[model samples]
Target: MPAFALEAEQRKWCEELRTLAARELRPLADAGEEGRINRELLAALGELGLLGRLFAPDGRPASALDLCLLRESLAYSCTEAETALALQGLGAGPVALAGTDGQRARWLTEVTAGRAVAAFALSEPGAGSDAAALALDAEPDGKGAGHGWRLTGSKTWISNAPHADVFTVFARTVKGAGSRGVTAFLVPAGRPGLGGEPLEMLSPHPVGTVTFDGVPVTRDDLLGEVDGGFGVAMRTLNLFRPSVGAFATGMAQAALDAAVEHAGTRRAFGGTLRDLQSVSHQLAETATRVEAARLLVYAAAAAYDRGEPDIPRRAAMAKLLATETAQQAVDAAVQIHGAAALQRGHLLEHLYREVRAPRIYEGASEVQRSIIAKELYS
Candidate 1:
């Protein structure tokens, strides 16, 4: 695909996704309880074969471009669906990337089919952005060489937590080793001593806190080499970061479209809102910013697809700019829509709430800037 323009097939696929989200996913999302996982939406995605696209059944890693397209297209019409798809990819990414054949066969298929929910358990009470500072302790169970570890700690701000059928949990294995000490574990939800509670959040997504009380895992639960989980987490983030930007871009575009339509139709000062120079210029600027952000997101996704070495910097730049731009675009859209935008159930109102969280989650804008600077210096 071109950096600036999607190919014909890509555009057609995006259109299909948009249609599916609007016609099928949006209803399920609307019927879903806020702050909870929508299993019906997941099942719909699975039925559409959209979930299967997140990872290759042939064992190849999912394409970054494909992921971005899926997110952007779905987000344009149904953010809940987009989030469900992204969470599946984010949580099960490590398994697809480096899990043993048994692990992949067991979890990945179920995840794709929406028969099982997955959660990425990396953040803790003290370790939001500083993932390496995670305090989840995983002590050896002392069952000899092939024995499993005992996990005992708490993980908060975990997406799809408590309710998810499985979790890719990160725990500290080596004392005082920092990043190198962290190891990834695949823990099934019903294990003894594993429990969690839902956390009500500004974004209407399934987020919660999970507690591990001497949770035991066997060798089969390990993801990748022990004490090498940091790489696994980083790899998944790097792959998904650009798609995060794509998600933001889609929201921005939706807001822009809303603003444009409202401006053309709503009369103000004896004319339509679009007749005002201020409104027109603001919309123009917002549209331009959205387009630029979209380009950056596409470029970053393309770079990742090409296996470029500068993906860290590119992905950071894309996510930072796109998320910030989305916030701006959504705000401007609300502003242009005036009091109606703030009313309950308004599209702009929903977007206003949705746009703020992306800048904070995945990686904060400050964190993205830090990544870009670090990549530059390195």
Candidate 2:
């Protein structure tokens, strides 16, 4: 498949996703509270078979391109639904990659069914972008080799926290080893010494702090090899990065569409906003940028699917361009719409809140640039 254009069936699927998001998912999103898990919406995604698509029954995982398309289509109309779906994939992905058969048989099915909520607990108050700087300690139990470890420390800015049924937690197991010291544990919420509380945030998702006092995790709970959690995290990030760009592109496209419609109809100085060269020019520029960002996202996903080298550079470029373009497109859309766009319930207002976080999460824009530069020099 070409990076610039999707196949006919793919395009049709995207259209259907957009319609489903608008007609079915949007209402569920509206009925749910902000900064909390929406089980209903998640269940709906499962019922529609969207969540199940994240992992394949044939043991072949879904391609990065499929993830990109699913994310972009859902995001175009229902950012909340898109976020929920993405979070599920992020939280449960490590299990699919390196879990034991029993683990996979247990939690994965629940996750795909949306019966169990999952959270990826990686970032902490002191280590948001520097994942290797993680401070969460996984102290070995002196009981013996199979005795397991006790987790101690806190993970902040975690999505679906305080409510998720399970968490893929990264903790410093070999301290002072930088990225090499970490270990990934599949921690269940009902375990002793595990606790969390939600935090109010600018974006409309559940973000919070999860604390571990002496959270006991046996070897059975380990996702990957001990002291190899960083690689698992990176692998998960690599897969999801381009899909993040797809999400941003979806928002940009939505913003551009809104701007174009407003410019074509709303009366201005002497005529419609489209008659003014400044408004028309801004819309045109934004449209071009959005298309460029979308193409970059597609190209990156294609590279990942094809197992191409230099994926880090392309993924970073795609995320950087698409997220930045989304911010610009949203800001332009708001400007064209004037104060009406700022109205609390306006689509642009929702998108305005939605657009800023992508540049920070997954990987910040600065982080992406650093990744791109490092890959270039290497």
Candidate 3:
């Protein structure tokens, strides 16, 4: 690889992934319910060894660059599969990062095998992007539960909630501690007071609110030390942030490709749409922005893999640029395709819906800007 460009093998692998997503994964995604977990699709990813790649073949974690490539390639042809794969990583990532051997042996195996689902339960209704402001209380259990704590509160907008077999939950273990008081726990779905309800959203993924009515967890269930959960969450997000950009870049590339093809072939006033200076110019700009976003994503991912200190800033820049560019590219595609793009089942329509949420989730665009600004001064 020439510093910024992908190596030949990497490019070949990405092409293969795109083809596999289109041919093997798309059908499973098409058959799944709009807002439900697609177990079949997940299973297909596992069977193809995509899920296992979340961790490396040597039991060590995979590189951030590998994650970006996988996500981008999958998103290029099948956003649903990309989302499913990403969620698996997001929800179970902490375990691979800080979990005990027992926890890894139990959940990570099932997770990678597609037999067990996992969720990262960090965002509460009151704490969306303000992670440190979370108020889920973790009071000590006094019912002879032996070093256990009782978690009481609710988490909203959690991906794969109400259905995940396990959750890496964050809660406030000490009052007045801000981020310092938070703790991470691995709580199974069937815990005594654990329950959840699915929420309908604009994007087609399983998101919901989980209510913890004094859910019990022991020290054995803790992920990392008490009050160390915030670090765990941040580490996971730092690694994933650039890959989120990769996801957006893939979507943008797809939209740009569609727009270019349409402009080249779709008839308009006396000639093909490409002959129109207005249409061609818009495409030229969109293509440039998309490529720039992809390069930024690659750089950020590479920085993360290199264990550089400025990862936060790079990740934020990559995500902010790529996601914003994806929205623009999709909108431009829809505009070029005109009303036909708005029709049901149109590729542009699906992308139009899919493109809006990345801007909001996993730390919104506004939040990304804040991080970048803070990091610059620090």
Candidate 4:
């Protein structure tokens, strides 16, 4: 096999994951209530030992390529399972990367075991793509011997907000410092003054809003250096962005497979759909795009694993291209399937909804373009 291709072991692992997802995870995902945390699915992930793979145990960083492969394989058969795994990594990433040994011992183990749900709370009502502009304030706790801070603000669109056992919350610690003022805190769900409510969304996931009305945090809660949380957040995003692209590519592959299968069987105008030049050409274009996107995703993941300096540009390009391509591929799949694809519970219908959110989250396509352009000039 070429260097770009998956090694035999990697290919076998991916196939096993797909089989596990289809046979075990997909049923739990289907039974899960929309907009709610699927603890059962998470527990299943832990039971299968897959959750432990998200973090390296030897005091080394997790491989970005492994992350991408896991996500893509799980996403190919069970997007809900893939999402549960990714959310755990995203929420606990700061702690896994920068938390104190005590913090790691307290949270990381439980997170890996799926006994504790975690959330990454960075985006606020005013922040979103402008993450540095987050307004959640963490004022010094004057009455707590100056050893703690009181958090007061709201975070919107936080995945696993309402149900997560702990959250890596970002708040402003120094006024007028822009990104430098931010601090990341590990706030437990039962903390006083911390509250959350679920938000209904088109996609089936546990995303919601969190409100912090003077939630108190001590030095122990800090995930990284105070006033330097932005770096931690960026590092996590930089690592995961390409995997997000891989996730999108997996969905694209599934959609392409469905389209190809349908075209080969479904007849139109006295002949099979694949016999038509127009239908065949559309499928061909989508297949080419999906392969290109997958290659870009693989390259970005490999670069990240290698500790390459141009990771930001490569990751942005991978995510932007793959997500946009997934949307197009899924849309084309729907077009070929016609009205049957629109029916509830259809694979194409589910993918149609799932593929759109990736383009918007983990930094939008516009933000990605800006990052790439900046990298090019620098």
Candidate 5:
């Protein structure tokens, strides 16, 4: 809230997390989207406390400033794998922030500990930026005994869906349709009639369509109040959307790093590529952008962690800068590497795809601008 910056403890955690991810997770980063995540990788992150950051020290952020730093570091090493790890916190954040104690102990604890994976099921074929347009339904059963409702309808483009053991799902509870009718649910995986099919997207992290048909849910499973999840989900996004920006900063930094290395080593016209003002200037500009974006994301993340009042505007700016900078940085890296950069097995190629998805997810870049403008105008 008051110009948040890194502390020694946050810096220490970032150093340790980067070492672990660079050692264990970075090597497996570009195994194609299908092979991106696994139990071993999850376990590795859990052991390093990547997943535990939100819950490890009394269920608050381990460090207000480290959220962006850790995510940036992880993204630099491996964005896809790192994002899956990061979402464990974001995906389950509504529960961590507002769940019933029972719900917290049941789903939140396990997800933080990496014993299970958590997912967010909010996007649908018809609803994304217009979250209020959600069509998923949660209705009281005709013969309700203990269970309060049954959720039905489909959610698309869900991250961590295939392997996730539970989901923080948003569905309609009141008879009225739209986001106002929505309520968040702590839906357990392997429940009867719950769907876990996968979808083919440009950049992948086990995303797909989740069809909930008469899935039994108890009153305790409802996150926030009836038709109150609109506020709950928005609050959760306010906490995480900046981290998505941090993830972008990490990626763009990676691209800058790649560009630097390539420019220094590769030769052009009987001289090193680094001698080219064009090449050197691009790398310099990208480096500057990465640092600026990283700082913006951190400032927003810390403000959110501190319960700052103007978080929506700051968070929107953070997301906007980080996501857009990541795309430009990766493109610069590709330019430095020429044709080789776009080849398979190249990190930038994968990053090129990975960077695009963040803008679309959390909220589209255009939507973020709209949000910031609306708030500023108001």
Candidate 6:
């Protein structure tokens, strides 16, 4: 399938997204750049319905192709902003898929309007790759009490914790059952006893630890049913994981762009760098790997758009292969740049750090490999 099959109008929208991002976000990545998701840029996206693009104009579930196209283009220029926007989509996406119409109209509306930021709160200090190992606890509140559920536990390394106005918190239901006992909650941040502490990482993205010390949640916010959260979270990932691949695609594209420019302009051995077989071969290899990765990602995304049966396996494969290839491509770009790209401020070096996070989060490389292997064997 074509990487993207777009009408002229959608093509214009994609161009606008890329052009606006470069004009606005590119400068934020330079010189001690916090790369924070600035308010104005976000509002601009909201104004164009980019923030609210997941839903169709008819107000139903969004087309997968549209989601992928917007995310892939956004990822190319600003990885952090891309991630932030993704968090907004993902945090409320589960409820949209599984929640009552009221839930989507309530939480998702604010998020799409840019009035609130949304986040998914599933990862814990101990449950990095093994999602089933999650240990946060949520028990039914006494019937006489005002609240329906009381959550008590700590979740570490959560994105948007510090800034999130609302979060989709997951917790264990009870001990008797395994996956059945796990439940998901829509918990607002700063609800009395909740706590958030920022985490420092290689990339300058917003991350923090969240703790719920007897946080109250209304029964109305329970996504799906008790223990139904497993499917909710998994299905959500199955849909959004390809965007992680898109982030990888962006890194690879950026790296390849840098390398090609350097190869044509830089001189060695009385010739342009590309004149050498070693450099040319590397260029060819980078190009080939990037195209391969792009195809894999696009195929998986296409499957999602088509409602194919094997989307989980396809998405996992796409996420893993695309990210690894993108990393390799970026590394090659850094190598090709020699010393110039090694500078801390260089785009390749910045992308080198930015790309590493995707491998570790949203289902790690090893985790996806295991999932794919299990699917293949079973």
**Model 3 lDDT-worst window of ten:** 53-62
lDDT by residue for model 4 (327-369), tens: 9999999999999999999999999989989999999999999
Candidate 5: 10-residue stretch with minimal lDDT:
28-37
User: Which runs of model 5 end up more than 4 angstroms from their true locations?
Assistant: 1-5, 27-37, 60-64, 143-147, 175-177
lDDT of 1: 0.92
Clashing pairs in 3: none
How do the residues 1-378 of candidate 1 rate in per-residue lDDT, one tens digit apiece? 353678999999999989989998999999999889999999988998999999987644689989999999999999999999999999999999879988888998999999899999998899988888998999999867898899999999999988999999999999889999999999999999999999998888899999999999888899999999999999989999999999999999999999999999999899999999999999999999999999999999888988878888899999999999999999999999999999988888888888898998878999999999998788
Which tens-of-lDDT digit does each residue in 72-153 have in candidate 5? 7787776655876777887778887778777777776677667888888899889988888888888787664565888888
RMSD of 4: 1.6
Task: State the C-alpha lDDT per candidate.
Answer: 0.92, 0.92, 0.93, 0.92, 0.80, 0.79
Looking at model 6, residue 192 earns an lDDT score of 72
Query: What shift in Å separates residue 257 of candidate 5 from its native position after superposition?
Result: 0.9
- Per-residue CA lDDT of model 6 for 147-234, tens digit only, reads 4877888898787776688889888887656666788888876787788787887876778889888888887878888678888889
RMSD each, Å? 1.2, 1.3, 1.6, 1.6, 2.2, 2.4
Q: How far off is residue 13 in model 6, in Å? A: 4.5
Quote the positional error of residue 359 for candidate 5 in Å.
Answer: 0.7
Give Cα distance to truth, residue 129, candidate 4, Å. 0.5
Number of colliding residue pairs in each model: 0, 0, 0, 0, 1, 1
For candidate 2, give the lDDT: 0.92
For residues 1-378, write the lDDT of model 2, one tens digit per residue: 353678999999999999999999999999999878999999999999999888877433578899999999999999999999999999998888777888888887898889999899999989998999999999998776787999999999899998999999999999789998999999998999999999999999988999999999999999889999999999888888999999999999998999899889998788999999999899989999989998999999988989988888888999999999999999999999999999998999999999999999978999999998898788
After superposing candidate 4 on the true structure, give the runs of residues whose Cα lies further than 4 Å from its correct spot. 1-3, 143-146
Better of 4 and 5 by lDDT: 4
